[model samples]
Target: MTHPDDDDELIQELALAGQGIALVKMEGRVFLRFEGVVDEAGLHVPYALVPAQGVLAKPSKWRKLEREARAALIAERANERARRELDEHVRAFVRELAEECEDAGLAPMDFLHTLADLQTSEPAGAIFDRIRQRLGHAVERQREEQHAERTRQSINLAEYPASFDVARRLPRRFIALLGPTNSGKTHKAMEALAKAASGVYLAPLRLLALENYERLLEVERHGKPLAVSLVTGEERRLAEGATHVASTVEMLDTRTAVDVAVIDEIQMLADRDRGAAWTAAVCGAPARTVYLVGAPEARRAIEALAERLECPLEVHVLKRKGPLAMEPGPVRKVKNLRPGDALIAFSRRDVLMWRDMVAEMGHSVATVYGNLSPEVRRAQAQRFRDGSADIVVGTDAIAMGLNMPIQRIVMTASIKFNGVEEEEIPAALARQIAGRAGRYGIHEEGLVAGYDADTHEVMRSLLKEKPVPLNTSGFAVAPTLEHLHRIAAVTGETALAKLLKRFIHNIDVPDGFFYPRITEDQNERAEWLDTLPLTVAEKFTLSLVPVTTRVASLQSAWEHWAMSLAKKKVTRLRTDDYVLHHMTLQEVEDICRLYSAYAWLGYRLPEYFPDVTLAQDMSREASSRVDSMLQDQNASARRRRPRR
Candidate 1:
């Protein structure tokens, strides 16, 4: 009997038809399967009819096999004769052959088998060789046509959307706004793009993206969809109603075709962690008009890049284009800060202490730092801008966003931690952070002063010209916060190292080196717990689980602790033993008696009872929580959803 499974049916049918009248051998009988039945198309009909299991083969079986074999041979001969005559016209004949085989409704293997028989004088191998050669040539021609079309598309340099007149007076596809620090390059770029029908603006940092989106709303004219948006991290889409979008470079992809593309802080192309975003925008933006807003230092780079794309670069040089009533001179450092000045520091503790000191000095103050939420930063920045905050203490976060008018800038220190190690500020960073003092079109001129013993060096670095933009490969791929949080939950360093391998940074590192380093950096909570006066047995028990085995184990433990301590006031203590505090009372007293405010926070931590203040020490945190609860109650009373 013929096989019932469709896949094997074609193979079985072809085998039976080829042998014709073939005997089927069983335990006690011989049998034959019939095939090849014909329809009106003069095609032979094929089937397989096996004899009964117990029946012996009759004498007529041999005769039937002989007759079918002769017919198959004759059919094969006719096919070969036709193919030989059609050699010069093989392309057209093969097309016809393929179509005929398809129309005959034959299975793939069967069609190949019959086609193989077309080689009467030669062999099956030779026939296949001829077909493959013809097919390859056809495929090559098709490929060439496709390539030619792509070339045409790439060469046709018409501006995207065909909505702009870039070819006329501009005589170029793109216009770049170049200027020095705080020279209003971005402001002008935004003005130009806002005039356009639709466009996208890219900021180097997500904080700046939020700043730009808010600024766009203030400047927006008409009923135009101020549908400005921001995309960063996983939290995407704000300014959803605006047609325009201000976003970080990482959020940029070739998904939408905008009329204009504005890239701010073009000098960020030198950033190693995110340089690729700038490069991609330069090379891959599909916008018709691209405005690069940055300092004049990027002119050469911009020109070279434009030349590579065979496009002309229009440079708009803006040199301090704003009100000119104020004078810029060498800054004078003061031991005591003046009211209505901005004091900048690089560390969180320094900022908080500075704010406390300045307030104690009878100045209303606000603070800005990387740790503060964006909304709080904005509000604090606005207070400074409006003269509400006499002094704003912050880190480098204020260097990029929030325009504030200031007469003076007081830099607390010149050194900063650049992710890995402490280093002196680079010239570019010094200029950028210093540039925040004077707002073009707002302040006539800005005074930037440094306060530390090395004030002269800091001032010189700030006044010095920015260096040539450095070349960076791209943004460094860092582990996600989720990964860090997961490691924070795991007990031991070994387990954390295992998970670190999955990160792009530690993928190639060995466990011995990678585990300890990543665990120390990422699993801070676990380390904190071990240090929090736990017994040796408890510590060992906690360390039982290797972080590398499964990140979820750590995550679970961390979540449990986080939930438990979410409302608690935990102190961060540094001293190893309380007895040492008692035994070395004189030594500790001398240490504490020393009035170096900086040293008290920095070096005397080991002698201090609790090195760092806990949440309970700060009455402000508790007051803030009370305020939050009251606000929630008020919102409920007003029948409104509480703003997160």
Candidate 2:
């Protein structure tokens, strides 16, 4: 139960274990932090044994694999988006031109002469001035789209060199896709997993997981059901004996058995809390083969490890697959809000503010915040895709994965809070975000702009230059013991025994190796059930609880909720997070006057419903008198109901 001691023995053990950590000096002080720790246990510890200045934010090499994979997907989606935008812009122009001809009310010859005479080149001539003004608007629109095309082309060019080594023949197992950004890594991974008899694709982030799950369903070959499932920390979609499971590695764990395992973003092996999942997936996958896909920077190290472990590792480098047209037109500056444009912001509050601001301008707006439920977020994204929502304002949550056709991207701000500190997005992150514009299949081109009037000049310069290549070697950090234990717990003793028999699984984990320690906590189960208050229909919808586990009290509540829905009535019940947060806010506001803003606006901003007054008071009263209130309300409600 004791935490690992912070000492040299542990550091040396981590170093000798080939866990990516090294000794260094910072400001003359010796320091130690994860340099390439890619094992399961090393990744869980947050603070490293190092001087503060030497702390690196980079993830492990395995994570680089994921970045490369995801980067490829971004390229594909970006190209598609660009092509669509190009077609739309051209159509809009033609439509306007046709309307203009109809409104002239003159013969073609007369119209031509009138149009010519409408302006003259002579000095101080009003006729010529008027003619030039009319032509200017048309010229501006043309320039805007042309610039978009150029940006799109630039993105295409960068990806071309990355997808080259791609081959048609599918590998049986041990297919490792290695490439740089925009190389189409994930696309290939998704293809392999979809074609495999049974497989699971693991993503680093929940957003990516959801995106992969949807894509799997979309590309599913029609026949009998694909039996695909999705798993996140809070959500689970299990089908009876389902074969395909696209899940976040943190959610799936290594104890899982499958015919094939597609581990996306293997470079996340450098992550502190989550890298262990990636490490476990790579080192302990039960599948016949594990496709280790990622960027070139991480290839040598990964290949070296595969050799040491005696596992067959085949490396496939996808040369950049597509070509981008040269000298795409100049980027258009978009300081003003447009109906069809996407404004990229960095925070939830900013997304809300922008949504309200743009909505007031008579444009349909949809907000995509990370805190929203997955179902709600997906629905919001769909609204944008179908053009129901003119503007989709969001945090970095919309940065990658999902494809939306957008003509231009407006950067509202450059600063982003990376959990602990506020940092300006480097050119690499900027290029990635800006690349969202002008999807290839969606538009012929795209536009990338920064909001600061000062930065318009800088943006112009950046647009002219190629995006910098991302580093891959920086990702080889060790995994954490916490992850190893979680994997052990999920796999259970029986499955672990089977995996241990496999040579690949046996190669790793130290000698006299004991399984990861796991505490059986029933509180977690109770907490999970309390989190989502489901109706009877929803219970049926998810089919999660076994018949043996169902309780009368819980069943009655679910039945009542279901009946309320049938009657088209709202339930008084609140989401569990809302209830818990509301109480937390009340405690904050109750402390003082100035601190009230922090409570009301900071912590509980989402829970403060405008239509509900005295919400805090009601919450406090309920907490203080839960038994009494429940008894009275339950008795009265039962009396009012007819006898069953």
TM-score on alpha carbons, each prediction:
0.48, 0.46
* Per-residue C-alpha lDDT of model 2 across residues 1-644, encoded as one tens digit per residue: 21223223444543422543443334423333322211121121121222223322222421333433433432333233433343343334334433454454322222223322222122212332443455556555554444344333322311221221211122224678865434577788888888878878888765678788877776556666477788764345677877788787755545446678888766555444445455456555667778887655456656644653456788898753332221233323332666546787787667766666566555666666654434445666777789877777777666555567766677777678866699776554565556556655666666666666544544555545654433332222221323223333433322222222221122222321112211112122323333344332232222222111233433444344334433545544232323333443223222222121112221212232221223334433433333233223333433544434
Per-residue CA lDDT of model 1 for 1-644, tens digit only, reads 22224313432544534544333344443333322232223333232333222133343442344444533433343233333333323333344445644554433234333442341333223454665565556555544444434333332222221212332223236688987667778878888777767778888765688777776766656755466676543234555455678777756645566788898888776565455467667755657788988867677777766764566678999876443221233334332677557788888778766666566555666677764544456667776778766777778888877677766677777788887798887777776777776676666776677675476455665566556753332222233333333333332232333334333332322212111122333444445444444433233223322222223433463334333333332324333422222333222212221211212222222232132233112222322332333223323333432334
RMSD for all candidates, in order, please.
22.1, 36.6
Q: What is the lDDT of candidate 1?
A: 0.51
The clash tally of candidate 1 reads 20
Model 1 misplaced stretches (Cα beyond 4 Å): 1-172, 219-225, 238-242, 322-335, 472-644
lDDT value, residue 553 of candidate 2: 38
Q: Which ten residues in a row have the lowest lDDT in candidate 2?
A: 36-45
